[model samples]
Target: MMDYVWFIRWFGPSDIYSTQLGELAHRVVKKLYGLGNKKRDPRQIGRRLRRVEWAKRAFDRRGIHTKRRRQQAVANKDDSITTHYHIGKSNKKRLDLKTYTHSRDPAAKGFWTKLQDHILGRLMQHEFDGDTHETFTDDDRKHIRIKDRKLVELQTLRVNYTTYDIRRDQDTINPRNHADVMMLSPEDEPGAHPYWYARVLRIFRVQVISTHPLASTVLSGPQEMEILWVRWLGVEPGYHSGFQRGRLPKVGFVDEADPFAFGFLAPAHIIRGCHLMPSFSDGRTAGLLQTSEPTAARKTDEIDDWQFFYVGIFVDRDMFMRYFPGGGVGHTANQGFFQSTPDNAENEPRGEESGDEEDELESDSEMHQTTMPPSQAQAEQPFAIDSDESVDGESSHDSDESFDSDPEGDDDLNETDVDDWQWDDGYGSA
Candidate 1:
């Protein structure tokens, strides 16, 4: 029964053809047998019958299999390339940078930029300030000192690095070791602290002048920093956009004021390049997406090494319909559950009985008019009633015999009336 609905969608009219073909097979089998060989032994007959059954089964199965193969081939050939692809979840190979770089069918490019323009209300400013140096190439800037005895040793070559290396270097269980916090210092904070945190979705190592805003004006030396594009973590709770870290600490008098919504962007120091793990979550912390143990990620040791990056910008079919141009007006107008049907004058299709209703009413009224005599019809009219006279007595048509014959005349019986009181011959009170 469950498969009935599934089959209807997949096969459509195939069942009809199948039934017809089956009937033909049955007829052919019947004609070939005719009373089945009367001279054959019992064991021979049984074997022969089994062979026939096997042939029938094989025929049906082969037909079904061929039909299915043709359907699949047609689907593969005819499906449109322009259909909006859902990028929510995919295998590691699909999301990998190396695989993506080689493929002719590219994933949606400029997603981060478009998302920034749409949600953040401004584009990312391209400032040329040189403050970075390659540790492997330049001996003067091998290690960058961070806050609380933390230091970033830039030993990995940017050119040879894969997506896996970037993610492994950034993401971590310890909050201190997180890429976003690597450049942060206790003194820098309480002065000009970074309010938002983001995972480095992408990084560009192109040459650019990344000078310190204040120090550049005073001194002549210019430094460079690697340009990083990041997907911001949301400050608001319950938005399905980003992975949930723990709740922010209460900072003010209000005990329950939620953290500020933090996905908006401007020119800020990007001290992190990290992977966003796609997972389910509790209200506070990140959780596993799978309900069963040994997730697909954990099933293979290689999967654990593969990194992923995702922002909740991609829209599904339903979400696209909501914000689609000119569609919202009609959607809002017809938002209610009630649907208004157009008038019959507009030539909408009606049931057979529905159109006959007016004709039936008119015919019944004409029959009623003809059944009554002219005098009776006239007496029943509203103008026939006299204004000053009372007409309470019985009409001329009311006869004693006619009254006695009426079944409802029994309702007029009253033993308490003096005129109606009568005695039976044998009973005194009758």
Candidate 2:
């Protein structure tokens, strides 16, 4: 009946009518009947129904949107001053900073030190209050406060972002499972790659309390701070990759000495979670960090990172849109980049939508227009914030979290329909 969707305009819109709709009412009425004495139960049911309606009306009048139904977390591009995100309805667990066994919790490895450095970063480094990358002096670090050490681990990160088509949408991100994340590249010339990529090692919330004179305004007392401990991956130094090349962006673990190899990040800095499939042919090696001194960032038993991974842009329409920028990945007034420069315009083919890509966009766009999934709607508002910052590990975040593979709802979005990032005989000039 999907083909009949065009008739919706002609016949007027209608909900799916079925016997189950009518039948479900009886289940509720029976439930109410069972709760009271059978005598005059019909009257009781009617009274209960009226009470429910009255309560709903009261809620509407007071604008009391319950948290359970407050699902429109995707703010529109025009309204969003800060990134909007949610964690769905999963329960969160907090852990103490120590196992009392000489800080041997591989997961929480470097938790205390990294977190302490993070406090210093927040106080000195982060771009808070219109400041750029500045750090506290040795004297300043002495005055910086660090109190609570408990870490709150979240299960999911529902990142609400604006679709390229100027509509709001979101992706559910989980560190244990859906761990890959993407953000706008800090690079100037993005002809090769336009976004930064990272594999989230863990998601945490820290309650920061500072008594330092420098942190009086920002850390007045105590505040809940959300951060992601991520291992940063870099685009292959000279690998020419993009859909324009009929290939995905080739990325790999950066050198251990790179400041961004690992870091803590403020949640708002992320654009959205991404799909990154391993470049199996390239193989994995423990040498990225070291096999001898296994990093706590990896699983307890593992000491390797995928030598390389391919950006799976074709995983979904939104993801495809993000890479195929001209496909409309939330660029208003041609601002957020999706076009090549005049030098590479012909080589890159600006705004050139291949027939197949165009068809996919049209089909997805049509589906979008026809089906109004209740989960998504024209959001009434987007997120706003005064200040946000990236706590790029500048130092390795290799110091934290016990690695437990929580494989809940692992997404098998990989489709063999797309070609893999093929093997290249050699590398280009560095």
Candidate 3:
């Protein structure tokens, strides 16, 4: 007889017990005839017990206990453990198994949904607003990444002609001057013309240390160039009477220097001597002469000859050495003369009077002529006069009767007297 407790210990539950009973029967021999007394030999029985123990040990080592396996088998025996739960809706309004599991897990659902919404929102905003997603264009991005790139490039640009000053010792060493060339046109003129007589009053050479856009390149360095002074000249009658005959009763130097300033010793004086007498002729007439064709032909008797002349003073080195023996820069014979008026000429020895001793010294030394070529000599011949008698006639007869009248006739002169006196006497008489 099987001990029930032993059977329960060996086999596990009712279901396993039935299966084990069947398997045990298959392996048992029928010779177990007299169950009580016909027991097998102790050694054989021991061997069988040992075999069962080894089998139990093997099963234990594999972590497969009959009780737990029975419980698992029973639990999974039917479809009862395989339960279903609803999740998010699918295309057909039915819950998808994978998505249902994911949706049921709140953590996973929140993460995925938030990420999806953010991506979709960004895409929509890009499409609707037409915003650029890239910071740089394709070409620009590649250009920035290139290893060899120039930091700056050279280019040509336009600039205006302008002027600047150079001064020393509180004195304008180089006074108002002009750039060599500038283009100008009158309001009505069709094209620009070069004004040649526009004097360059001073010049400088400077390096263009730096620049802003519109500055001229002509002044870009410490280099020399001429500048011009722009001003008008005032002509007064009787100022030029002694030099060019009374015919030039009016005169002016269009380009004049302040008598008080230390001007360019040579050029300034030349300009001062070349007095300009404005022609009463129309500017249109003068402009016609500048054109290619002339309106009139000259008679055989009419000569086209014209004369040009210039006069300039040159100071010899000896003169400069005598006055400035130490040989300093900017030595000028007329420098002292500029400090005082001509009326005070006797007040001081005008820059050390040229002495005979100095002349002798210069003669001993190699003397050199400092004067410019004689071709520049101005024709200064005295004005041609028919006679001294004509001069007297012009002067005496042309005098106003007022000069000869007594104090009694001052109020009696009428409009006729004024008209009669208008032809000529001297300045303002006509």
Better of 1 and 2 by TM-score: 2
Per residue, candidate 1 scores C-alpha lDDT tens digits across 1-430 of 2233444664574446455456655554444355467555555555655665565457557753333234334433543333211111111211332222333321113232232232212112333211111121222112221122211212111111112111111112111122221122212222122123343322222112222332221243222332333333432332112101111211111011221111212223332222233432322221212123332112222222112223221222222222222222122212111122223323533324354676796675565455445786675543221212126732333322110110100011221112211112110111
Pairs that collide in candidate 2 are 75-382, 107-401, 107-402, 109-399, 164-328, 164-329, 164-330, 263-393
Models sorted by TM-score, best on top: 2, 1, 3
lDDT of model 1 at position 64 = 35
What C-alpha lDDT does candidate 3 achieve relative to the native structure?
0.24
- Cα-based TM-score, every candidate: 0.18, 0.54, 0.14
lDDT of each: 0.27, 0.56, 0.24
What digit string (tens of lDDT, one per residue) describes model 3 on residues 14-49?
A: 566345455544333232222225555555645654
Model 3, position 418, has a per-residue lDDT of 20
Per-residue lDDT tens digits of candidate 2, residues 116-209? 5566666544652211234545565455433455666666666777764456766767665677888766555535456777777766766676
